[model samples]
Target: MSMKLLAGSLIAAALTLAWGSPGLAGPARPLLLAQASQSAEDIFWQSVQNSTDPAMFQAYLDQVANGTFKGVYKPLAEIKLRALGKTAAPATPAPETTAQDRTTPPPATEPATPPPTQTAQDAASSPDIEACDRAAAHAMDDQKPANLPGVTFDKLDTSAAITACLRATKLADAPSREFFQLGRSYDKAGNYKEAMVAYKAAMEKGHKRAIYNVATGLMKTQRGVKKDPAAALALMERAVDEKVMFALSGLGDYYRLGVGGRRNYPKAIDYYNQAIAAGDSQGYVGLAIMTYDGTGIPRNRNKACDLWQKGSSLGDSNAADYSKRYCRYR
Candidate 1:
């Protein structure tokens, strides 16, 4: 599926989810302030890479005009707009204050004390973040790209993870990754609404793994998020571009199931093969299904059973069940 940015309202809505409201960060204000620079760069690049639509860059410029992505991405977005043969609308000038208004005395109040500044360590090194990582971090998360054998959903401590991640996300200097973990924690607990909120927040901050999660977990009928399989497919593709290797399996499923478009068996097989090559056991299950059904390849029960056995050995429950039920691979 070709990636495209949604309407500006939707984009802004997603950003609103991240900050709790437009122009207001609520309790997470300090956290957003702390990571603003990196988040802006990440969000800008991700949005730009996912689509070439001029409106995309325009939307970014609009965000900048409205008080986000001020320094770095603003110029870059303008440059992109120029390259695309479009020009950003000029900044709206502030209304000039009249001499009479300046002469009027404002109500008197006590002098305000500035709030204490928070450092990145306040959240990065937080014990709650550590607990969240220990309790719910997915093996395939980009944050731990090198660690591919972490706890599975069934083994996740949903309660503990949710508590810790929730605490971490509220910290004054929390990173976006904590929001991703919070989403995972809610997913494990069967709280789709909360999970969707957390995943969208993480996605807004440019968490690649959260992109995959939002595509697969939320962008479908009957999920907490409104159904939009086309958008989901686009997001999955973006995840692949971002080198979320596990997303290959997701693309395979999308193709095999014809969720966003017509079934393309060849594409499904190709994605599954790529995922398998990347050492994702879930890929084995997808290929096994195709082999067993003779969808794109010749029917080969033995080959399917072998594939399921391999996936089962890699800790995939669906593969284990299939292996046990058909292959007698106890």
Candidate 2:
């Protein structure tokens, strides 16, 4: 779908959610601290992204359904429930009052109801209820991303898995992590322009990973953005500065290949070392490749193969392939 359409849809859906879009980072929540002009709507959607309690979700939707935004927001609650992989519990029907016509004045066609049995409309009109709901709703999801496969979806728990999916699947959104995930999802889904828009949103929130991601995983290969090696290199550098583990490998590639500027084998090796120190096995692959080519380091087939083996053990896919090729032959 076109970005305009997708964004419009998401915006419409966002207007209805009670807990949030399904995603977290606690201490590094830049969205709440950075954006100062968020409306109640903005605050409300953000809460939907973080919340896990089914009751809370149901209550928020009830407010939307009964309140002023019923026409626009009621359907939104349904969408949110579906996204959560849940069905909204059936609301209990209000009971008929027992006061006899003879004893008490007939209740008005629409009588004032008490707290527990208030209809959706009543709940919606209560600004105080929504305001009170903010105490539980506005909190950012504090859970970390789960370990999902790069190629497959996992059974994600909606409540705590909001941030986890954003970071892992890269298809969801709320704010920083969500923005980046949506960008990645768009890229994979062939919506390059939409991806760029989402990435830009993430970048504005000071997301280092978004900088690298917007540059096409540091390859200068994505569409929508003007692809320049120098620009891509600069973005990777920014991510590396933030100590993003994978960015170290990307920085090494820029220096090793003279992608953005003149080749600096020494700098490449330096970055490779940094990546290795940061526990990214790709660092070993890059450094080993340099060793194999006698670029910066003296040519040492044994040393290169050994590095490849180590990287392979650490789960670097390229290193595993390289190990079979070089270690088997040499």
Candidate 3:
């Protein structure tokens, strides 16, 4: 049959179902079915002309009846009968099952447990945590370059590593072994800037080695703050106060070379005596040179030769060479 004739038949059936007998109706039912029929006709004709899939077209019709056509039309029951298809009755729903007859119980659920909280004391007492705190303390205590013991640099990168170590140590409230390591590292790296900082930090923390290192680094590089000879002299003096043998030797050299602002041969001699008293042979060699050169003191070649012999006996190589060439009397 033509789509128009089929649509007219479906509309007639819908109106009959909506109005019941039509002989005795209080008010005619709303023209819902008539409108729904017109909509359904438009969709069906468009789908057919467009060659839509038969299954999809049927599903579309079913959705229209259940959704947009819902409330406005008689239930799917009368609508299905009126639709252009072979008639079939709606299927009945199965009976509900009882609780006892249910197949399985839902899986058992565990009660949620909150995580334990740590007290401050408990946290402090934790072994792992205590170790970290101790390590940090050590690093802060040893942050100075000069105070570090047994520092041997294998390469420039080793020095860079030391700088990094010192930087890490500086963040702590006290000097640590790590700080000393850092200072040594920078010194090895030839990064005198960071090395001086690390040594000063160590010195401030009461590290004797760092005090000496600060003096030496400052003297060597003439950097980190102003290049003050007076300051270097003061630092070397402080190192002497600590009774460090190498610092005494360094002080003697500084005086002998007229560094740290002034030339004083007598002062140099005094410093060299201090170094010699501390069992440094190099001090003897310096004293011998001053006598040999007649620098600031009266010329005394014989006295110089005698001092060189004494220095050679203490394993000073320069003294040995001078004695071999000039101290035949010895």
Model 2 TM: 0.50
Which regions of candidate 2 fall more than 4 Å away from where they truly are? 1-173
Task: Write the residue-wise lDDT of candidate 3 on 26-60 in tens digits.
Answer: 65555565444444433333334222123323443
From the highest TM-score down, the ranking of the candidates is: 1, 2, 3
**Clashes in candidate 1: how many?**
0
Q: What C-alpha lDDT, on a 0 to 100 scale, does residue 240 get in candidate 1?
A: 89
Ranked by TM-score, the better of candidates 2 and 3 is: 2
Clashing pairs in 1: none
- In terms of TM-score, the best-performing candidate is 1
Model 2 residue 257 CA deviation (Å) reads 1.0
Question: How much lDDT does candidate 1 score?
Answer: 0.74
TM-scores for all candidates: the values are: 0.62, 0.50, 0.45
TM-score of 1: 0.62
Q: How many Å off is the CA of 169 in candidate 2?
A: 15
Candidate 1: regions farther than 4 A off: 1-113, 144-151
